[model samples]
Target: MSDEHPEPDGRTRHYGDFYGLSEPAGEGDVTLVIGNCQAESLRIFLDGGGLRTVRTPPIHELVEADLPHLQRWLARTRLLVAQPIRDGYHGMPLGTAELAAVLPGGGRLVRVPVIRFAGLYPAHVIVRPPSDPSLVPPLVEYHDIRTIAEAAGQPLAEDALTPDLVRRVAELSLSELRRREVANDTVVASDLFAAPSFDQMRTLNHPGNPVFAALAARVRERAGVPAFTVDPGRPVLVSVHAPRERAVLDAWSLDGEPTDHWVVGGAPIDSEEVRRAHLAWYAAHPDAVAAALARHADTLRLWRAITG
Candidate 1:
């Protein structure tokens, strides 16, 4: 849903550059960046460099809602910059190329590479806080996970505490900070989590990160469009813990359907008794687990070869 403003009834609010408020562009002049929350940072960067950019809603929203304003924006877009459509688990209805094919002007489409860092916190952590009593804090004095852990009287191990983890927590902390920064009396739920705090992290792309600017420049150069340019500054270095061969196999056995996050084929333990039996069996026959791991490694090697 769009906000009620002085502009036309159906137009979505243009958000970037100037804080507090933004005005819509003249007809057919907007640059539409097709992405999610990360696109906001790109919008900010583009606006700062003198480009009128607006982020399309998450892929799910666009495909489901079919909002009038969105259609209008798409029709009028001068340039379409896109990242892979990722909203939760479901695949996107269409990508930038397919979407551009339908737009009236057939705008220039620039696809950018998305560099994902292993967030200290998982996606589920944001959607659902830990259910374990030991993890939940009595009071959320600070929104950072480390602070919460300390508050819960279970400080994280030194090895577990990392810059990536801290930054990931900081990303959420920025959201929490915004929650407090805004006036509580008149704050709307949309505004509460709408824009990300650029202080801790610049863009979902991690603005200062090397990848953000590289992609932006590629869009500008390939599109042959003139826009002001500025240094993206330094990258915020953080450790990445993405799913890889070694890590994946170590955590799971080669056994059911392999989802992005889970290895379903492992030994089935439908009940507590089954689980206990499996554990006992593993203890007695440790080589079985090792053999399963070897199979997982083989699977990964084949995957890498095929994909690469």
Candidate 2:
């Protein structure tokens, strides 16, 4: 649901050099690298230097297989830039429990937290309070999964899914299912909760005779809201926030299923807000973010492998 809050004043705003490239040989210079099921690419730009392309790897090879060379390159670089694998980078926060309950029984859960970066657009940048004093000079910050994971004492697993881990995730899912049931019955149901994205609908297997039992249960727990049953005769359209609308549209254009309609939300997803909230929550409880991200990483890697 839409909640109106006073927008921050312009006077309080400060601008800084949010983007720069660093030389690979400089003492503090490190390459900012990013990769996933999509593709792997690295650029060598000296902090004062211009952009220089160094290497690019196939998306399939990078995520589905090992890239020790890439890891070594990252170890020597100054910064790492990439998206979060677990918890969403945008949209609402659907916790592990909630996601677990919603995931189709036979199908597993996949979380891909992305931070959008496209050719110097102000709106694309994420603004947040610096997590550390060292990160202060820059008004905005970009994080790499590697840096954060190391700091958290929970490094990324080469293999994300293991029997033990899967079982633990399943348990969390069950908890989410119960929680949703409670929320639906008691909490204020908002429009945001009512609108499920196309991706979400696929996860729930839209318009089916019965809604995904676990997902319905979790929705109840988190919002105490009732699940919508898609009208089988009519096409079910999925809607996404504005910021992500273009990317989502492009993706759907390439591979989206033909449906009755696909709708984009009226407002921006404002994922930066979600990230700020998550960071604050993590700051208060350090281990919590680490644990959640670890689970998220594994599932994402697995989803990539299977889908690729």
Candidate 3:
């Protein structure tokens, strides 16, 4: 779904960034970052830094009808930097392999790992679509599993939100991340997120600029591209910056300041308001709650252990 939803004014976007209106027209020598939302930000970090990457709409924003447009771009792509994606994504040939197959002969295909870090926000989890609501915002779709448990009459012992608990969970997360084999040259985000002092991740799956810059350096090393010389001068991932509680920062001993309010589409929203929306949303969509509980049983079980 498109990231931007309209506000009452019809002028404000629910979230904001590139609209792809003025993106580079179909051209060869394009380095396309193909994957989820993060890929778009990674592309931003790669540009003007010495790399000549094209900014296409985020893959998720495209649908099956956009295949011809995607194919046209792929036909001209000389260096395709991609993250792993499954077959037939968005009812189109958008997967890593699927996209690589359409690349012109001699087009270079490089894979980047999908980066996810949750140690600072253990209660949050991403519940992939098929069970997700249509046109729902990612920030809203970013269900706080703890809230889900409570709304479902399974209140977590929020006490489980402790440092030692976070540490153990982080270890498991890191181990799992390390095992996911991607490109031999892929730069893993585990290091940046581990005891991060700068709030490396804006959300569980959305990382801060530093992580993208690190990945860009690695990509440039492998792709032999130049580094970004100009900064958009502001955050590229400006859609949703989730709450980073002081307690979480303290527990992780991270150096960043705490953020209680949710930043949606460049606007600050009350944390309580977001929670209320999630609770009401959970009540309205019980199937999602069930799916989340089932899909994340192990993580929930770990919390259950602490609660008991």
Candidate 4:
């Protein structure tokens, strides 16, 4: 929103400037939210008076080259809200621990968990091609886990997409998510599984607004800030939405409209089109497919169990 519209190279790098508000009353009132894709929504919810909230490019997207931009923004941050990032991440000093080290005395750093729940779309995953890890995949990163399973020559049974199997996958998804989020600190949106207000997620990683609003309230509690007041009126993370299969809804007893098609940038996409494209891509690049299979091997084993 601050004229840094396009992420440097097409990745969601430059993001989260709300209400055209950039400057704060004091330098100590600056806050920066850093993490993966969900960080943008958190940044927007954290928007209001007092703190000049700015969100850096998603931490996973930042490279050694983007250090200057990250550092420039970090220098102005007094209240840094970040997910758990390890030091030397991406061969640079851009981790949450790394960034927190640069904060001045009395500056605050609030830890926010990276919220992800697969109860909504258990088959979807975000994978990086082994060839060019930076290339934004078609449809903006929603890949069916079954694609990688097939690429690895691991096929599922014809009847494996059952409600029972979906429920097990959802359980495994929750276990892995809690393992990652709880070990850090408070888990944001952990209660979203049966939340009455929202469906929890449009995809595995992209959460609905209520999840973010809850996270903002957590950040405010830790940062000693006033209540968040800026409401975007529309969904903030609406660029790409995964399908709401009937199986997933019944698996979690979720309440929402169901569509087998994906909604990308407000446009519907046939799931078959996505499957064909991904299969073709894998066929063209066998080596990359192998790498992805190997990387997701452990997860695949769990998925395999659910299928068989």
Candidate 5:
């Protein structure tokens, strides 16, 4: 297919450039899909499950009348799978529930919660010596990798401190950590991309990770669409790095007792294996992980004793 198509308004536009196209689909026969970048990957998975999807501008664009073609497509769509993103990157303020009122007859809706960014905000590391109560509380706060390296007395070369650069380091570190945890076991491959890093403040929806796949499967099942599975495993990163996302489904709009709604504050599906890996890593590295925990515990105890 040609990369660009002309709209009725006399402007040439490329369909699905912002979000990749699975296959050419007819108007009204297509599913209206919207979300962050992760939503784009889900479109790939859905296409793999045999569904035709078309990208529409986000709610903010809709409300502002930015992408005129989207408003027209809204009336023709048979189904919509909406995964609301954070309030940045052309995202909506809350949920995409506002679009429900404008759907065509017999239109079905599926809402998946937004993905949370792991390190969008600054993270502070508190350090207090275990043996010395008199030592000052040493705190190091950083959001990007350059600052992190600087704090560790290993500043990177000036050209090697971009957001993508920092993300590469985080990816390598996480991969190594997971490998050590598995220790020769055939671990499942899981690449989590919907996370905040030095490269970007907010993350789009990412697929391939188990939590993302589980959430997508729930949407498909509820809509009576074909089910698709993703990678079964996920990495247990720093909790602050993988914050719980915002809930997407609007309970008030349900025609009856709701069957399912997007979940927040925790993973939508069971991920005990991730937890098990973490525990195993700590167990195997008692001298490092255990000692670190002990130091933190001691710090907390000291703070409590002084306050009490």
Candidate 6:
């Protein structure tokens, strides 16, 4: 690893310098593997090296044209090093699919894939040339310490903690929290859709009614959630849960006036009265309130779900 280049935003850029080395004795048999989704750039280097480049068919390309060379090198070469393109790092671990193409004829690919940061695009190197494949090092897999502690039926408090265990527990806790957030989002979305306004809009508007357009606009502004309006107007003003201001406005008519009114055309209601009215409205419309709560909860949940 080397110092990363700085981007305009003071964040480190992905591009960086990388180097590889071949064993002095096995230099003649060595073949450096390189690949890229944009294959033209790699072709220039391959031509420069005077090494023959073989492009596998589009459907067959994964490790690029380096599979055959990799197989040959693994058989004879003592050291294998690669500097893969930056964007492809996530898929570095070699899977069975890639191994099926790269391993020598009749070679039994390992079930557990090896993890290496040696810059191999889409597939990591597995070194087992001189040594028997069975003698090769065990594949590395990361696990949080909390899992181990829970499995051992041991307490995770400081009184009996190890550094590894502490770190692992922290990792596991974060992962669990992320999972919970995802579940929360699903529950919220379901609740929002259950709102009376949503149902009213669906039944009245022939699919695209804009009667509750004001509520929809408010939702877009304050709630930042997806919602539709209803037609065949009635006293029902169902809306997903929103901020206090938006909720009050939707529950009772703002009517383009600053005054708060509980009904369609009543005198301005005070802040305290507005609060009471909002509560009463929500109480009366339990389904609508639940939908609003779900709508808010879903935002947090959906984010966790995607990230986790």
lDDT of 2: 0.31
| lDDT, model 1 | 0.40
lDDT of candidate 5 over 1-308, digit per residue (tens): 44495333311234543233333553324676776555654554454455556654444344434445555666766777775433433453324565555789888777654443322221112233345422331111112222333433444454432343234333443454355435422112223433432222222222234445555666678778777664424332212222221111121121223122112234332223333443343344334333344533432232233334
lDDT of each: 0.40, 0.31, 0.70, 0.70, 0.41, 0.27
Clashing pairs in 5: 38-205, 38-206, 118-241, 163-198, 163-199
Which parts of model 6 are misplaced by more than 4 Å?
1-68, 74-94, 111-308
For each candidate in turn, the TM-score is 0.41, 0.22, 0.82, 0.81, 0.39, 0.17
Q: Poorest 10 consecutive residues of model 5 by lDDT?
A: 245-254
Residue ranges of candidate 4 with Cα displaced over 4 Å = 1-28, 60-69, 195-198, 255-257, 295-308
Give one digit per residue, the lDDT tens place, for model 3 in 132-237: 5453423455878778898789888756777766665666666666666343345565666655644477777778877787878777777766554446578666
In angstroms, give how far residue 211 of model 3 lies from its true place: 0.5
Clashing pairs in 6: 84-119, 145-168, 146-168, 146-169, 185-301, 201-230, 241-292, 260-269
Report residue 242 deviation for candidate 3 (angstroms): 1.6
- In the range 188-267, model 1's lDDT, one tens digit per residue, is 22222223222222222233434344446556666676655646463332221111222222222322232222111233
Give the per-residue lDDT of model 6 (tens digit) for 1-308.
33584332211121111111222221122323333222222222222122222322111243434344345444532212222223333354333244334544433221110111111000111222132222322111111122222223332332232223222332333344345435432111112212223222211111112222332333223322233333333333222111122322233332332222222123333434534444443344444333333432332233233334
Q: How badly does each model clash, as a count of residue pairs? A: 2, 23, 7, 1, 5, 8
TM-score of 3: 0.82
Worst 10 residues of 6 by lDDT: 113-122
* Candidate 6 clash figure, as a count: 8
